[model samples]
Target chain A: MSHLKHVAIAGATGAVGVEMLRCLEQRNFPVGQLTLLASARSAGKTVKFKGTDVTIKELKADSFEGVDIALFSAGGGISKEFIPHAVKAGAVVVDNSSAYRMDDSVPLVVPEINAEDVKKHKGIIANPNCTTAITLMALWPLHQAFGVKRLFASSYQAVSGTGAQAIEELERQTREWAKAERKWDDVRLPADQVKVYPHQIAFNALPHVDSFLDSGYTKEEMKMENEGRKIMHHPTLRASVTCVRVPVFRAHSVAVSAEFEKPVTVEAAYEVLRTAKGLDLVDDPTLKKYPLALDVAGKDNCAVGRLRLDCALDNGLAFWVAGDQLLKGAALNAVQIAECLV
Target chain B: MSHLKHVAIAGATGAVGVEMLRCLEQRNFPVGQLTLLASARSAGKTVKFKGTDVTIKELKADSFEGVDIALFSAGGGISKEFIPHAVKAGAVVVDNSSAYRMDDSVPLVVPEINAEDVKKHKGIIANPNCTTAITLMALWPLHQAFGVKRLFASSYQAVSGTGAQAIEELERQTREWAKAERKWDDVRLPADQVKVYPHQIAFNALPHVDSFLDSGYTKEEMKMENEGRKIMHHPTLRASVTCVRVPVFRAHSVAVSAEFEKPVTVEAAYEVLRTAKGLDLVDDPTLKKYPLALDVAGKDNCAVGRLRLDCALDNGLAFWVAGDQLLKGAALNAVQIAECLV
Candidate 1:
């Protein structure tokens, strides 16, 4: 376990998969061997890892034969089908899909919140949902300082959270919009161009992020509370979340109103968040500086800003958090969990 | 007042101002004469109203001489300076600026919520803030049925709410990003190109919508509770609002968790929202149909959708409401208030 580990990334051609490679290389994650695995379509695609062209292999049940840590980010279905195989092949699986996140046997790990939970994983360690993970990067730190009771949050999610194809869809739509020289009033992307999302994502905001449950909350919306409780080890943490996909290409921003067991001040929250790992406090409203999605894109650290005392609830604080959904929300967090393994 | 009143639209060149002209024309406000007023920079510019070229005059203290109804949208500063003169000249002012909204003497009106309040105004009738008006359009109906006590809201506000220059800034910055052909990972507009906003609004979300208050909520954010209490005639009503400026050019959307005195259900909410004036119930998530910003843009009616029972609070309902910021939020609402006077 002390030696450099062999790492295999499933869905290597996807958005988060590619970022996982970068995080491994940038953070110098002591990888003895790196294997890139994807679907048959992207099998031969070459991804440059540390200036070396690593050919992506077709992901199969045998993909984790000699891999020590297999990172899965394809989708819930792919992770469900192959993650068990990775576990059977004696490889620890760090799954980025929601397929295994809620499983009692699987440890939902956000390294900063519950790194010790990584040690308790039998075979698979599930990566928290991107929105949930990014939120907890700040929330977990605050929860440590003041016991958090519940939160009401709304996410301004990005197109990249939908995967590589959705990113392409947004880019294509933006170009189509530019080509038409349409005024802002006529900015709806033509019906034919809006494929990835239900409606146009060019300049619109979609309130529905994931599939809706009978409770009327989207799966993505409930993931914040579901995953937050697990990651923070606080079973009673209630979260009412509205997941919205905005026009941004990368990075997700969340506005949260959290009520705590003890009274929380903006200054105290700032002091606690300033020293928190993998998070930066960027709350200066006078200068009009806060956690903006465009600025946080491609960055590892999640940024928290717009810190204020909630006017609605006693002992409540409202804040805005921005993080690269691909990095802190997905890849970088996954790789950091792998780092905790050895 | 009844015989085809003369209408003067201050800030007639701005986004909401232009929409005011459209609303007056579309809604057939029985305009005998239309006067367009703006700053000296746009003094001679001709804006087409009812297919007639109406020249813009500088909005001076004496501009409301022959005007019967003055719809002011220039800004708070201009309204403060010139509105007294408009009232002095015997023109009833439907002020769109926040200058007179909270004034005990000025009637802050949302036509749908309190059209009766228009009769109570001495001279100036204040228009509610864009986000607050859109939210109250839906909330008022539910409040009637269930008796709302408080609400926690987050707004996905469009750039048009910041006026015409901010709209242009978004359009120009978007074009800049498109021309650069930047990929999703590198999707930031150059720092030098960002203006009109403290941060770039293209493909990004800014949490700071208006100037911050000592309480940490932006002036724009607090307007909901402040204006809601006035418009709804409910002094005890509490609202915690987060106002965010998104890349969209028009249409402001709000996600609200409203707690009421009586019990609420999804069926009951739909029934109320469907019959509510100036609101369209657009809540069918199964069909992927909801109140989208793009669809709601340019539409006179505010759309309420994604109706669900709140999982976090007792007797609470969660819903998403979107409206054309220029329409129900400003221009059309102002025109409707003027209609009340007629």
Candidate 2:
């Protein structure tokens, strides 16, 4: 491990990309050299890091020449095309996309849960899905205390998770709605105004998240179970998830009803959750305190709340977990993985 | 049944109350006389009914005199204090609040499924909880086919379900947010501006809906199982629910995974839901079509979509349902009960 390493951030202009830059600077990851990479359209744009402008270069086969550690936040297509080059050039890749998460050779890592998995990475470590990472921050602790059998979850995902365009879309639609000065009941937007989402997302909830799979669950919904099993090394773990895109700007919240092999009480679950690394126990219903998307946005630590015993399942528990998808879910996790390499 | 029956609407100016007036006018209920009742602050305010303005009187024990049927939408405290008065005044009351729904003598009814229960009412008939009623519109039909054993559900509830003031709160906060010209990532609302909700409802989701029970489920979350038993006549039925309040101004959506005793298929569930009274099958995942809260806001019929076999449970089916909470969940159901009385 080098004391000071050359670090390159792919998709450096994206929502997660900007946050990766901030996390590196804030955490002061011994960076001797900084390189930013994006598409041709974003190439030449300068991103500020440590009060200095770092120019984004157009990603090419030779882009990873001298970079020792590369963090990828671009879509899966870009990762698939460019990650092999990074690996070939001897740059260890930490991908924040679904491209390589389920790969047998690629280590799917959430630093807190599976930092050991990073050492076995075949030059590519995969960051878990945003919602999955946020959820497992709390679930991993509980799973350690009481073996988890299955979980039923529903996500209140933010627009920013979709990228900068969706963020702009939510803001544009909201501004359009407010500019119209429409009363509460009369709030309506035309079809032409909504683009990023299939339906109007302003003041609405879309039950669809990622593309629908043949099994009826969206590709995004299955990531919880698929990624959870890999990261937790619990092969038989089952998760049923419904992912919905909400009007929120950032931070994703998931409501989980987890059934475990052992009987779990609120106090026991809290005991495990309170001391969990990278997680905050935000329960206290009497004070109206819970992990809210509004309250969790921009924070690195994910918050868990609304812990209760499951009413239907045997030896079950219900809880809500929230976190900034860009932080623990993406950029921060990516940087932490890079830290593991050095 | 009297031809010219007098009808009084308690909580006449509330969110559901205003919708109840619309349903009564649109459905053209046999209302020979209309009496609007509210608190003292709302007294003398006139609500237009069928080209006539009816002045609201302050609610009291005497207000229900000569009223043949009264529709109550006020909170439980108001219903507890005033519903008996309406019944004593010779009026059969259809209370929308949860005050009397669980009582032994009070017949909780969703007219389509349990209008027969209305006949057994001693003096009061209770409208089911908003989420329960909307969900049952789809679940009841399927339960008949598959013999539902238990259900796990999460709700995307609207602000309108909270009452007129909540609607105002969402609107006011949204306006404040837009007026501030804050970027999506920089949206930080002040504490004092939030009134109706414990946290900011704009661009956020709250997992707490109603008061939290000792078991960790909100009182509203338990209503599905509690009210479903009485309405569906399935006393042994079980449900685990997480009720969440989203930013939507009206209409509510629920993502449900129902495990049944009998084998159920997507095609079979579709067949049953297609002809289900007050339900429309809106699923077409290939085209990205599903039941959206915005699409069902002003509609009379609830919509169910995203039908798929539950990947995690045996004989299980997953579906999404949405409806106007003010209509099918409250006002229309209450009005339907009154029609049953006549």
RMSD of each: 1.2, 1.0
What local lDDT score does residue B152 receive in model 2, on the 0 to 100 scale? 92
The reply for model 1, stretches above 4 Å from the true place, is none
Model 2 residue pairs with clashes: none
DockQ for all models, in order? 0.83, 0.83
Query: Candidate 2, residues B1-342: lDDT per residue as tens digits?
Result: 479889999999888898889988999999999999999999999889999989999999899889999999989999999998999989999999999999999999998898888889988999999999999999999999999999999999999899988998888888998999988987768887799988888989999899988887899999999999989999999899999999998899999989999998999999999999999999998998899998898999999998989877889998899999999988999999989998
Tell me the number of clashing residue pairs for each predicted model. Answer: 0, 0
| Worst window of 10 by summed lDDT in candidate 2 chain B | B184-193
Alpha-carbon lDDT of model 1: 0.90
